[model samples]
Each structure stands twice: as structure tokens, then as C-alpha cells.
Target: MFKKGLLTGVLLFGLFFGAGNLIFPPNIGVLSGDYFIYAISGFIVSAVGLATFTLIVSLFTGKGYQELMSDLIHPKFALVYLVALYLTIGPLFAIPRTATTSFSIGIEPVLANEYKGIGLSVFAIIYFAFTYWLAVSPTKLLDRIGKVLTPLFAGMIVLIIILGLQQLPHSPMNVASIDYSGAGKAFGSGVLEGYNTLDALAAVAFSVVAMDTLKTFEFKTQKDYKRTILFAGVSVASLFSVLYVGLALLGNYFKLPDTFKGNVGTYILSEMTQRVFGPSAQVFLAVMVIVTCLTTTVGLVVSISKFFNTIYTKFTYITYVRLFCLLGFMISNFGLDTIISLAVPVLLVLYPITIVIALLVCLHQLVTLSKVGIRLTMGIVTILSFLQVLSTINGFHYFKTVISLIPYHDIGVPWLLPAVVGVALAIILPYQKITKFKNNAEEKK
Candidate 1:
């Protein structure tokens, strides 16, 4: 049980610790400056909140997130959720960002400007090709690689924290707004930015994988499974909190130049490593980033492939796995920046819906909400989410105007108020009871 729980925790950590996450918090620290403490507190709340919520839902369902959603609604709705999740986590967004960020942070600095693009292309091809091979086999090689890379990533991150702390007293005063005009608004913005990590969403998506790990270890009882998941969640939460604090502190101390602007988190790490560690810092950082990113890519590809394989049993699992890898590679070569910009709108649409679903699943009993009620609420929310996403992506002035007139943005989060209202209505609505009186009346016929 101990071994199984530990392994599950490691895998969960790997899934949650993507390249973008590594880059974001530090940047938040840098931006928040003197406001670093407030921002970090808010960031930790969202980060931990999402993880805890998903863990609770997964534990109760004893099923994958998709299966849980299917129970609440229909199989078709579940399928839609799965597709959106795969697209968001796989080729369209997170997967590509891993490869691109790895190259940019880890490898690009060491190369001459002229060859960097070509170098990144070549590295990506090799990276995805290797990812494809492991994903198809799912063998001991991938396991060994994960075991090796996990420690190395942790060590490098720790080294970064140590270096940043050593420089803190020597660092300049925070010029950026630490105490903004509105405390509530500042905290809320920080919390929202933390949501960009999407660890919680990934937790739901990866919970099945975690559960399977438990089953593999011969955990036959429900009690054992619950304990294992709770342990895993606690372990992941601890690790994330420590790392976030470290990175946030690093960002808080470093005063970046104007050119060092835009997602300054990655730059802070890169520059700090260069300053303290010397010329080899680039290589060290690159290797760590590449390894971390590669592991993430392989995991995502495998998960998505498994999902598709279940729906279409005609194709061998290996075949589908290879297909996902190839497709991901094709999309990733376009560059990371492009992939992220394109994915933002989609994420906006899906994230709110996903959050609402997870919340509903957790609160179903108290809400006395029927499957029909859940579906109705989700349907209404999804439509509004779709419009918000469209407006965001296309810069549609008219859509924005329409959204503003709605109760939420005209009132916050277009679907939030509507979902609450829908839930209230569900609880209040009366239905005829299927009682002994009714049964007796039918029997009289």
C-alpha cells in the first residue's frame, strides 16, 4: 500500500508539473512585486482548491471523471467532455507548450539565433518521436526515465530556490504594486491567474490513471482505494505548495529589465541560473526542462490514446497511441506561442463548464438535483461559455455587447449566476411522488 501510494503521488505530481506551470508562478511573483505575498496566497488558494475538489470527487465516484460525468448526464455529453479535455490537454494546447517551452528555455539560449528555430524543430521531432515510441509500448523504459527525471527536476527547482534566497537581501525594493488600490480585486485577479495552471482539471482527467495504479498494487477494498487517493492528493498538494512558494519568492526578489518582460517567470529562472551558475546554467536548465516536458508529453499522449481506444475498439490501442503522437507532433512544430494563443479561448469555454460539473458532482445530494436538472444547467452554461469564448477569440464587439446585457457580465462569469439560479429552481420544483397510494390505484385497474 505504501509503495502504491508513493508511486501514485509521483505520477500525479508529474502530471501536474507542466512547463507552463513552472513558468507562470514566478512571473506572477515578478509582476506582483511587493504584492508578492498577497498574490502567492491567492495563487495557492486556487491551485490547492482545484486539486482538493477533484480529489474528493474522484474518491467518491471510484470511477474516471468521464464515467462520473456520464452518470450525471448522458454518455454523449460525457463524450463531448472527453473530446474537449483531450484537445485542451493534448496536441492543441498543453502538450505542444511542453515541447516548445522546453526548447525555448532549455535549449534555445545555447544556440546561435540563426540556428535556434531549426534546432528547436529537430529537437521537437526527436522528442515527439521518442514520446511516440514509449507511448506505444508503455514499458519499463518509460518508468525508468520517469524515476530518473523526477529527482533531477526536483533538484534543479530546489537549486533555483536556494540561489534566489541567497540573493534576496541584495535584491532591490519591489517597484511593482504589492498593495493595489483594491485588495479584493487584487486577490481575485491573482486567483484567476493561478487557474491558468489547470492542475485541477488535469487531476480529474488523470484520476483514473491514479486509481488504476492503486488497483495494480492489489488494493481490493473501497477503504484502501479511498485512503490511497487521499494520500496521493495530500502529497501532491504539499509538493505544489512548496514549489509555488519557492518560485513566488524568486520572482519577488528579482528586478527584471524591460526587455526581460512578458512571462518573466521563465526569464527569471534563466537569468538567475546564468548569473549564479555561469555558462553551463543554460545547458543544465535545458536538460531539466526537456526531461520534464518529455515526460508530460508521453503521459498526455498515452491518456488521450487510451480514451479514444475505449470508444473505438476496432483499432488496436497501439495504433491509436501512435496516431495521437503523430498528430501532436504535427501540431507542435508550428511553435508554442501560436498553440497557447489558439488554446486560450477554448480553455475559457471548457474550464468553467468543467468546474461547474465537478462542483455539481460533489454537491448533488444536497442540491437534490436530478440528472435532468444537471443536464439542463450544464446545457445553459455551455451555451453561454461558448459565446464568451467566441467573443474572446474573435474580438467580437457585438458578442461582448450581448454578454454584457446578460445577468452576469452585465452581472461575473457568465454561467456562474445562471448555474446557481438553475440549481435553485431544480430544488424548488415539485414532482408527483411514486407512493403506495399511486400503486394501489393502478392495481385497482
Candidate 2:
């Protein structure tokens, strides 16, 4: 049980820890500056806390997140949410961002300046080609990502963080905005930055993969398997906490100028490698980034392909895989900056709903919410999240005035209070016979 749980945990970490996980810590580290500890504490709360809990919900319930949502909400809403999440977390955004991010920071450093576009295009093809190759063989995923890439990626990240920490920062911390100037604000900044990593969404996508991996092992009872799965979630929380702190500290150590900045996090990391390993830094960092992104791309590709194929049997798994890989290849060529820009609005809307769902689901285990409660709470959050989406656009400044009335809106989470209100309202509302329900408490959990 110990051996299987530990291995499963390692793979879980590999799936959750990629792309945004790679980029955000240091970016927020620099942004947090003197208050990094406070910032990272908040970061762990959202990133590790939410993701671990999300994994646990699926693990203990023995259901995929999409399935869980269907059980909790209307099947139609669940379908819409699942498809949107899969699109954002798979082909449309995440998978391609992996290619663009790896190329921008990892490969482009070694490319000839004039051939940057050509370099990105070439790298995208090769990167996705290898990703598709590995993804086609889903059976090997645990060995390839968990046993091999996870350790190698961890080693490289640890090497850079440890070495980078030995030297003091090149310059003072970057000036933070009003939202990051104090302990509270710094913590909020960290939380919001962590939220942007889009990991909680990945937790939902990857949960089935972990469960499927567990089925391959022999367990005496359902309880035993559930226990092992919970252990894996805890392991991921522990692993991410350690890595985020170290990486944030590394972010604190390097300060690059504006002219030199590409992706702030990537450039700062590139600067660290140059100082530590000199001329070989580019190749080494490139290898690390490639492995980090590859591990995730393979995971997302396989998970979504299996999911789409199952949900809509009109398309074959192989057909979906090819389409996703090809689509990812096309979008990645737009570059990392463009991809990030496109993702921001979508994430803003979807993440709040995700958070509410995760929170409600976790709470459901303690005491079941009536159908009215669930619907009302989700309704409030959905509206606010859409408004947040609009708030990010031009000529939407007026939305801020209304949003500002909400507590903690400054740090980008305006939905939190409203969600709480919905829950309270649910409790206050009259309960009807049809609203009565029970939680998914299988096997005495």
C-alpha cells in the first residue's frame, strides 16, 4: 500500500506541477519581495490547498470531477462546465501554452536572434510530435512521467533553486502595486497568482488518470484503495509546498531589467542559470523546461483524449489525440504572451465557478446541501464570474466600482464573499421535500 500510494502520489505531482506551476512562483516571488513568506503562505493555500482537496474529492468519491458535478448539479450544466474546462485546460489553452512557454524560455535562448519565429515553429512541431508519441502509449505514463520526468524535473528545479539562493539578489525587489505592499496584500497577491496557475482545473482533469493507475494495483478492499489515494493527495500537497517556497526564493534572488525581460519569470530563471552554469545554462534550462512541459502535455493529451472519446463516441481516441495535438501546435505558434493574454478572461470566469464547486463538494461530505442551496450558490458565483470576465475588458471600468464594494476585491477574488452569501442564503431558504438528498458516502467514508 505504501509503495503504490507513494508512486501514485509522485505521478499526481507530475500531472499538477507544470507550465503555470513552473512560471508563477518566481514571478510572484519577485512581486512579493520582502513579503515573500507571507505571499507564498497564501500561495500554498490556494495552489496546494485547492488542488489537493479537489483531488481528494474525486479520489474519495471514486468519481471523475465531471461525474461529481453531474451528481451535484444538473447533467446539462455539468456537461457544459466539463467541456469548457477540458477546452481551456487541454487543446485551446494549456497544452499549447506548454509549447509556447517552453519555447520562449527554454529553446529560444539558444536560437539565433533573427530566426526566433522559425525557432518557435520548429520547436513546437518537435515538442508536440514527441508529446503525441508518448501520449499515444497511455500505459507507460506512470513510468515516463512519474518515475523518470518527475525526478529529473525536480532535480533540475532543486539544483537551480539551491544554487540560485547562494547568491543575493542582483538588485532590490521590484516595486509591487498597492495589492502587494503589505502582509495582507502580499498574501492576497500570492493567492491570486496561485489561482492563475489553473491547477485546480487540472486536478479535475487528472483525477481519473490517478484513479485508473490505482486500479492497475491490487488492493484487498475498497477502503484500502481509498486510503492509498488520499495518501497520494497529501503527498502532492507536501511536494508542491516545498517546491513553491524554494522556487519563490529563487525568484527573490534575481532581478532583471525591463529591456532584458521577456517573460519575467522565465527571464529571471535564465539569468539565474547563466550566473550558476555560465555558457551551459541555456541547454540545461532548456532540457529541464522541455521535460517539465512534456510531462504535462502528455498527461493532458491522454486524459482529455480518453474523456472526449468516452463522452462523444462519434470520434475515436486516436482521432481526438491527433486533432488536439495539431490544434495545440497551431495555437502555440502565436507565442506565449499571446496565449497568456487569451487565457486570462476565460480563467477569470471559469476559476470562480471551479472554486465554488470544489468548496461546495468538500462541504457536501460533511453535510449535504439541498438542491436549492447548491443552485442558488452556483447561480450567484456564475453571474459574478461573468462580470469579472467583462471587468477585464476595456470600457469595463464601471464594473470595478460595483466589484469594489465586495471584500477582498483588490486582490482579484470578488467571488469569495458572494459565494459565502449564497451558502448562507441557501441555509436561510425553506427546504422542500424534493430538496432533500444525501452525500456520496460509499464504503463508510
Candidate 3:
């Protein structure tokens, strides 16, 4: 149990700690500046807390994402939601972004202007090809990633943190930025920043991978497997929180105008390593980024392909893997900016629904919320999310203003009240007793 839990925890960490994980928190740190602690406190809750909650709910379901959603919402919605979820995590945005991030941070800076495009093209091919090879066989995923790659990844991250701390001055030199002026706004910004990591969504998608890997351990009962997942989830949450704090501090250390400019968290990391340990450390940083990105890419491909093949078995799993990998490779060549720009709108719509689902799933286990309540809550949140999305389009200024009035709306999470109302309506509707009484009557017959 100990060994399996340790390995599983590391695997979960690897899957969660990908391109965004490496880049975003540091930027958040710089933005938060001297208020890094207060801001990251909020960041950790939304980021790490969300992932842990997702994993625990998945464990309780003892099933992958399919049944988890199907039980709560209509099966039809489950199918549609899962498809969108998989696509977002797999080829459409995430998979390509990994390659682009790795290229921009790891390879792009080192190359001259003339060679950048070709360099990324060549890198994408090699990266996805290797990801395909690993993902082609999902059963060996634990052996390849959990037992091997994750430790190396974890080690490098730790080394980067340690070396970074060694370089910090006797005191902080930078002033707190106005972006995080007060604790409330700072905390809110941190919470919003967590969205960039997308671990909350990935946790659900990766639950399938975790379940499949757990089967190999041959746990005697479902309860045991869930217990193992709980252990792993705790470990993952703890590790991620620590790393996020460390990375943010490192970002704060490099908060000077020249170093902290633009979306260059990776470059900041590389510069930090080189300054502390010498130019040789840049190789270590690049290798670490590549491995972390590669592991995450492989896991996403495996999860997407395996889930799809199960539903549409006409194409073998490997074939789906190859197809997805091909699509990812093609999309990756478009570079990071394009992938991110396209992703923002979709994620804005998707994340609210995902968060509501995670919350409802956990809430249901503790309280007897009716199915109607769950459905209503999701429906209301979904509609509000759509309204929010539509407001971004042309001629919707009035709608956007209306949504912005919701509590915490300015921070981009306006669906909380709607979700609460959904639960309240579900409670007041009398649907639970009606459904129960109807079931009892039918059983008597």
C-alpha cells in the first residue's frame, strides 16, 4: 500500500504539474510581488484544493469520469461534457500548449530568429512521437511515469527551488504591486490565477488514468483502492502547494523590471538556475521542463484515447492515440499564443461547469441533495456561464454589466450565487420526496 500510494501520488503530481504549472504561479508571484504570501494563500486553495477535491470525489465514485457525471446529470449530458473535457485536455488546447510552452521556454530563447520556426517544428514532431510511443500502451503508464519519470521531475523542481532560495537577498527589494493592493483583492487574484493551471479539470480527466493504474496493483476491494487514492491525493496536494509557494517566491526574487517582464516564467527559472549554479543548470532546467511537459502530454493522450476507444471500439486504442498525437502535433506548430487565445474562451465557459460539478459531487456524498437539485444547480450555473461567455461577444455590453454586478463577478467567478440558488431551489422543490414516494409505490406493486 505504501509503495503503490507513493508511486500513484507522484504520478498524479506529474500529470498535474505540466506547462501551466511551471509558468503561471511565478507570474502570479510577480504580480502579487511583496504580498506573495497572502495572494498565494488564495491561489493554493483554488488550485490545490480543487484538484484534491476532484480526486476524492472520483475515488468515492469508484468509477472514472463517465459514471461520476452520468450519476449526477443526465447520461447524455455526461457524454457531451466528457467529450468536450477530453478534447480540451487532449488535442484542441492542452496537448499543443505543452509543446509550444516547452519550445518557447526551453528551446526558443536559445535559438536565433531565423531558426525558431523550424526548431519548434522539429521539436513538436519528436515530442509527440515519444508521447505516442508511451501512450500507445496505457497499462505500462505507472511503470514508465510513476516509478521512473516523476522522481526525476520532482528532484529537478526541488533543486531549482533550493538554488533559488540560496540566491535571494537578505531582504525583499521590491514593493508590493498595486495589483494585489489589499488582502481581499490579492487573494481573489490568486484564486483566479489558479485557473491558468487547469489542474481542477485535469484531476477529473486523470481520474480515469489513476483508476486504470490502480487496477494493476490488484487491490482486494474497491474500498482499498479509494483509500489509496485518498492517500495519493493528499500527497499530491501537499507537494503542489509547496512547489507553488517556492516558485512564487523565486518569481518575487526576480521581480526586477528586466527579469519579470512578459510571459517568461520559464526564462526566469532558467536565469535563476544559471545564476545560482552556473550555465550548466540551464540544461537541467530545460530537461526538467521537457520531461514534465512530456509526462503530462503522455498522460493526457492516454486518457483521451483510452476513454474514446472504450466508447467507439471500432478503432483500437493505439489508433486513437496515434490520431490524437497527429492532431496535437499539427496544432502545436501554431505556437503558444494561438493555442492560449483559442483556449481562453472555451475554458471560460467550461471551468465554471467543471467547478460546480466537483462541488456538487462532494456535497452529495455528505448531504442528501436530490438529483433534481444537482441538475438544477448545474443547469443554472451552465446558463449563467453561457451568458457570461456571450457577453464577451459584440453588442453585449449591457449583459456583461449585469453579470459584473454579481458578488466576486469582477474576479471572473460570478456563478457561485446561482449554484447556491440551485441547491436552495432543489431543497424547496419537494422533488426528492416525490421521487422517493413514487419509487416506494412502484416497489410495492
TM-score of each: 0.87, 0.94, 0.92
Q: lDDT per residue, candidate 3, 212-270, as tens digits?
A: 77777878876777778878888899899989988888877774565444575766776
> Which prediction has the highest lDDT against the true structure?
2
| Model 2: number of backbone collisions | 0
Candidate 3 positional error at 355, Å: 1.7
Instruction: List lDDT for all candidates, in order.
Output: 0.71, 0.83, 0.80
| Candidate no. 3 TM-score | 0.92
Decide which is better by lDDT, 1 or 3.
Answer: 3
What's the CA RMSD for each of the models? 4.8, 3.2, 3.0
**TM-score top scorer:** 2
- lDDT by residue (303-382, candidate 1, tens digit) is 77778788888998888777777677667778766876787677667767877877777776344555556677888889
The pairs that clash in candidate 3 are none
Q: Give me the runs in candidate 2 sitting further than 4 Å from their true place.
A: 169-172, 258-260, 425-445
Candidate 3 weakest ten by summed lDDT: 432-441
Scored by Cα lDDT, where does model 2 land? 0.83
